[model samples]
Target: MTTTETPGADTVRPRWGAERIGNAIFAAVVFGLGVFALVGAFAIRVPAGQAIGPQVFPFAVAVILLGSGAALVISALRGQVAPREEGEDIDPDAKTDWWTILKLVALLVAVLLLLELLGWWMVAALLFGGVAWTLGAKRPWVAFLVGLVIGIGTQLLFGEGLGLFLPRGAAFDWWYGPGPLFG
Candidate 1:
């Protein structure tokens, strides 16, 4: 196939634009991750006399990551990159809402810390409510109620129905008693 090139396209170094630099950095990260995965997979122990050991999946994953990362790095180095998004992109001139971002991040950290003590249900509810409130929900109380329902429902579904080990609240042991509710 005939390949067409613009004037000076055969230059040794492609233009070091922001997009190209970002793409190259991302590609390098992926390549580094692939190397890490491959090395970790080699460290995995294979059980004796097993037809398909645990290492099989890890090795397969490593190969896929390595191949994809190598391809990305090559494409990036060649200055063949892709746009992040297609249509309806965010306005470039618009200022970032740092307050909202900070609140949401704080909420996430709080949830992570309180997950064990307050339980998944309470943490999930708080997280949902906090996020909704931060995002300017019309009714914050209603959002909290909805969050509560969601938390209980998810706990019942994943914890009770699916038999997953979801906490029943360490702080509120009186509410859950000995075993999980409906478990």
Candidate 2:
């Protein structure tokens, strides 16, 4: 018999039981939701004179989710744990860089504040630039331009063309005449 020696072999150990238990619990919760959805589909009445109602689609989705969740639970019970190719124990409370989160939150807040003052185009542009910069973007001006295009483009297409009443900001009044649009 031949044995191969590996450097730093003493540090490697199998994952703890808690991770497996946590995963099992998550699987169980998903399974329970699936069951709930499946049951809910039958609890509601289908409207008369409708060939395909809401109940049918929800029921089909629920059944599919139920089957998949059941399969996952069964696989977990059969000792088929998720493979940890990286050899690191999955810790839920692990530290992640919060800069992106802060940036996104700031963006949301800025958007809300600037919506009435600067309008969707300017607000979205500012938010996108800020977020991109915070997330290590090298060119924030590009992000700003992209954000402006996307924000105003959506409004023009959905709100103006399709006649959807998306919320407009005070800047809309300043840029164009009264009553919500440029047309």
Clashing pairs in 1: none
Cα lDDT, all candidates? 0.82, 0.75
Model 1 agreement with the true structure over 1-183: per-residue lDDT tens digits: 997889876656558797788888888888888888889988977768989866777788888888888898898888875755545776655667999999999999998889889988888889888999999998888888888898989999989998766776678887666665733
Weakest lDDT window of 10 consecutive positions for candidate 1: 83-92
Q: Which regions of candidate 1 are displaced past 4 Å?
A: 1-90
Steric clash count of candidate 1: 0
Residue 172 CA displacement from its true place in model 1, Å: 1.1
TM-score between model 2 and native: 0.50
Steric collisions counted per model: 0, 0
Worst 10 residues of 2 by lDDT: 7-16
